[model samples]
Target: MSLVIGLTGGIASGKSTVVELLKKKNAVVVDADWIARQVVEPGTFAYKRIVREFGTQVVGADRKLDRTQLGRLIFGDESKRRQLNRITHPWIIFYMIRDCVMSVLMGRPFIVLDVPLLFETRRLLWLCTVTVVVVCDRDQQIDRLVRRNHLSREEALQRIDSQMPLQEKAAMAHFVLDNSGSLLALEEQVENLWQQLQCIRKQRLRYYKLFGTICFGILVGIPLCRSIATHL
Candidate 1:
């Protein structure tokens, strides 16, 4: 069995950097954003639904989702954003669950379900053994967004404000990874957390083995015992 960890952070909060560190350690990660894109590929049901709901203006000339346009359409309109989530969240959840099950069957040590909106949606929280939120100061986040995405401060702030506040997310998380300082400092935190999760994985594996053994005894041992007693 795998320990499923839910990893989340507001945009530009260094969540992807943490994910990269985990990947380097050979961690199994089910990325919700990647899955979201997959679920809405041009021919998929989600693509069809999105086009129908928002019209062709949301689609680019290449017949793919104009993510920038869609982002603009929803960021300022709370109702439309919820409507979009309503259309896509279920499909994303389905694929995520499938990936997690596959990881469990493959006996991965632990699986990370990386989601940007883990706290905002709250739909997949029940599936996680532990939750981690990567955080930085809001101003730092906005600055990173502006520098990385080439957005104006106002545009960057709009993106940040669209999600649940970083402080609130940190409060909700079982573990919080602070990325407000140097990359080396953040790496140290990730290393320590990885070690902790490894210990938890070992504990979970022991419990799973014990449970399987007990189940096997119930299924096979009782029948053999009954037969021997009857023969006697």
Candidate 2:
């Protein structure tokens, strides 16, 4: 059976970096951000829903989502953000599930679901047997977000504040990755986690086979010994 691992992190915590490295290792990486964008393409239900709810002004002349404009709108208000999430999440999860099944069908031994809001939804537990959370200090996260997204410190902090905190999510994660250090350190942690997971998958199979074989031998041996005792 294929292993489905959920990967999550707070904004700018190096979760994307981990995903990129995992791709280099040929692991199936299913990203939620990409799926969210896909489901909202010009003609999609999600697209129509947003245009209807927020108005046609959010759509660009190119017939696509005005992502920057929408981002500016939703990020400025909690209610608008919720509205956006409500419209996008159903379609995102729909394609996520379908794509996961397709990955299994395609013989992907392991599939990683990259979700930024994995902890908030709590639906990941239904499908993911294992969860890995990437984390960093609040200061580091704020710094990275500002640098990567070209936002002011306060804007970056506002974005981070919008999601579930790293501490809360990490508390329940099967594995926690610390990315507050240098690139090499982060890479080493990811590599170590990958190796540990591989070992666990193999050992779990070995344990099942070993226990089954032992149980079978005991059943057969006990019956034969009982028969011999009766004859004697």
| CA lDDT scores, all candidates in order | 0.92, 0.88
- TM-score of structure candidate 2: 0.86
Question: Candidate 1 has which clashing residue pairs, if any?
Answer: none
Clashes per prediction? 0, 0
Task: Candidate 2: give its CA RMSD in angstroms.
Answer: 3.9
What is candidate 1's TM-score against the reference?
0.90
lDDT of 2 by residue, 1-232 (tens): 5778899999999999999988887889889999988999988888989999998879899989998778778887999999999989888888888889899899787789999999898765678868999999999899888888788887887789899989999998999999989989989998998898788778767887999999999999999999999999
Off by over 4 Å in 2: 207-232
- In terms of TM-score, the best-performing candidate is 1
Looking at model 1, residue 31 earns an lDDT score of: 97
lDDT tens digits, residue span 118-229, model 1: 9898888988999999999888999999999887888788889999998999999888999999999999999999989888878878998999999999999999999999
